[model samples]
Target: MNATGSVSGAERVLLRLADEAIKMGDDVVLVSPSGPILQHIHPEVRHRECKPIGLNGLRSPVSILKYGASLLRAAIVLLPLMRSSNVLVINNTLASPLAFLFQKRLLWLLHDVLGNDLRGAIGKTASRFFRLVIPVSYAAANPLPTGTAVRVVLNGTPLRESKENFAREGTTSVIGCLAALTPWKGQKTLIKAVAELAGVDFRLEFAGSAFPGDEEYARELRVMAKESPVGEKIHFLGNVDPYMTLQSWDLMVLPSVAPEAMPLSLLEALSMGVPCIATNIGGSLEILRDINGDLVPPSQPHALAERIRELLNDEHRRMVLGEAGRDLVSTKYSLEERTKELYWVVAASTDMAGKVPPRR
Candidate 1:
């Protein structure tokens, strides 16, 4: 169950898992906020929309009251489903408390590092009630209670065949940053770095929309980009299909200042043989293990720009990195392998007995 309605990395991962479960002859039901985003899910999977909830991230008293009300409402809606299902897999920690009602039947999937104080406290309290806590990465698991029943399940992506080497007729190298346009995502840092390389023949493509309360921040990014020396070179592509468009880019950049759990974008890019330049923080360092890509210090435009320039000038190095990235993803982070691991955990947690099917 995902708390938010938006089609972000967590939502995509949940959908992929549900699809994999369906393929294995398991009945899959998705309970999320009702929206057009639901259209992306497989038709075989059952879809249910939870009642619209107010912003739970807000620290205001009204927000807290609304969050409580939303949880109560969610519990009421889910109680009936909980009775019929052998296990409940919750995708977000905000909904973890609902597991308290189901106890052993519930599995909480942690997709991010518990950064918020209040949320972390609540997640810690809720962890004791859950049968298991499956964090998507080691970074995600580090903040959880030491003694909790935790398993680190690294997220995966479909392995794309390496593309044929193509000569770029265009002069400018395309650098794509495929993430939400938020402050901590470091889009501003990237823009600053591009501004530093005023005469460089490279275009920066920002390909994501803002979060709910981050519209102003998106506007700020636009203003920042506009004020940059190479303002026209910065293009905000809003939201594009990364799988379809990522292959067109020469390089992928993830400049997040905050700790990412395990960014699906990074995985997807690597799977498509796209070399990455990311900030050396959170799961990124873990993702870029063994020099799969370049790692720059977070919030440093000069460092980021230097790496970007270094990559842009060296075609052979970029090709080698891209091939290595694809190899790394195919070997260590395939969707089928990770899904099998997830299925095993689910099977072990429940009383499936002989009904638990073998991995396909």
Candidate 2:
């Protein structure tokens, strides 16, 4: 798999696939712009730092130049990886659209829904280009691609086995906000919601880091907390270790102001059998609906708080939803199952001259 170096929702998915591939006794090599954040891979898995491509561009003209230059460097390195392997998998099409253009039978794992407006930091022209070009290019290949050309890989949680000793119950009513402390993540809105839940006894744990040089947002959160009635209830467990953070929470709250393609945090929470309260925007609603928990309208702090309050008030409801979530995850979001399917997707494409093959 060829992944960009930076840690984001997409990269974590690739890491999970690497772990699963190694566990199943397959030869897996994780190629990235750099090393990974979670370094828990088996010795059989190879880690290589491919020549950095698109490492230093932010949707400017310089970005186009850097992107092209980086890919050129990556091409020199990727050929051997592709030659040595039977199938090619990529996180997204940005780096290796050529792989698709050249009919390499690539499996592009899609994290977000693509429209004109949702191209990360890229500008309108580039976004339009990608939206227009990617589908057409993939369709031109041998095994005529389908929606399955882009596999939607969801995050999987580790199930804790039932034990004989009575389990000491941890805090069941936790408001877990796992997004970064950016304005779009709606940290302030969540804090306001907690403040509104003044008399309610609940704990709010913020689990993520601030963007580069955005300590001011952290200060703002502190100030907002101090102003709120439940200010003392909010704790910032800044930049949590993924495993530790998942272990510590009973439920997760995702209140993104901006539309997300898919939130790895929410999926991770669901995997751990933790119910989630998220806004009905982007893929959050699509993924969270009818399985685990409530979906409130975006920017409605009172409504968000109320949904959380309902879960808190009814332990039976919480357990039922959480259990349903676990079952849904087991059936739909198992990492091993997804990767195996992904490999087959790539293998099918490879053998069929990049055409998307019909299901048997």
Candidate 3:
């Protein structure tokens, strides 16, 4: 997107991707509106903040004019940045009714399950214009017209700097959720489930801020947490560092009601040797299992509460799961390895068209 106010999974991936590109001796430039995400980008990368309008449908004449004006502004802002780069990576179609303008060099990093919704329909149409369509997981690649080129590259997390025993050793067990506070993330369900465990020595913590427009939902969550029977146990610890956050929690839960692409939060937890319990939806099933972790039915407080109780009570199981989780991540999800694969995929595509800048 040309502008973003908060960082989510997509932004995390972009940061890593930019870091890798710069390490490989390419000049990297981040073009977006001034936002919180800029703070995380690599220092070597150039930042070109722009004021392009967000994604919207033009149902009226005034809207169409505004959209046209924004597109013109975006084109103007991007012109200087485009000369030194050949490949353009876009996570969403947010700044565009203009995808075709950069058709030959554009790569669509698909992060949604394109299943007939308006966004999906737009994705289906936009797929035709991109040089390569890179979806984060198989779950995110779909419903496009015939012969659309596609590739699925899973997101990755960095391995811990030290294989420190990052496990929680507190007498009071801590259960945490590490995602932005959005209604669809199902934080309320987690709170309700945590409340069911009366007399259990545990604390439920949420470690993220709301995405820009979702502040109201965050407030609602705080209210619900305060009203919960285990009100004292439910804590809102907003935007803590993921590495430090996961280390303090015995168990992590992702209770998403909506489909996910590939969640980096779970990746970070697994990398830190923390066992995760996520609801079965979207990419959760792809990430967690009974072997390394557990998955419960989405939005079910009883099932959620029961599983939480079992894991909190069984220290041996949590340990085994944690070891297995760390092993799995070390083998399959290292950003170092994924960076090579990403370059291979992007390079392979660019080789066919001779479009990407040479990696010096």
Rank candidates by TM-score, best first.
1, 3, 2
Q: List the lowest-lDDT window of 10 residues for candidate 1.
A: 161-170
Candidate 3 ranges with C-alpha deviation above 4 Å: 52-72, 79-84, 93-97, 142-145, 161-169, 290-292, 351-360
In the range 1-360, model 3's lDDT, one tens digit per residue, is 434634788877777777877877777788777888777888998888777464444567897677667767877876665565767777755553346676666777776666566556666877888777888876676555677788888888887732246444658988999998988799989988988898899888899988765788999999999998899998988878888777788889999987787788988888877888997767777778635469998889999999999999898898888888777778878787776667667767763344364564
Off by over 4 Å in 1: 53-56, 163-168, 356-360
Whole-model lDDT values for every prediction: 0.82, 0.62, 0.77
Better of 1 and 3 by lDDT: 1
Each candidate structure's TM-score, on Cα atoms with residue i matched to residue i, is: 0.94, 0.74, 0.88
For residues 265-327, what per-residue lDDT tens digits would candidate 2 score against the true structure? Answer: 876777666678888877677677757468898899899888878878877876677777767
Q: What 10-residue stretch in candidate 3 is worst by lDDT?
A: 161-170
For model 3, name the residue pairs that clash.
none
User: Candidate 1, overall lDDT?
Assistant: 0.82
The superposed Cα distance between candidate 1 and the true structure at residue 162, in angstroms, equals 2.6
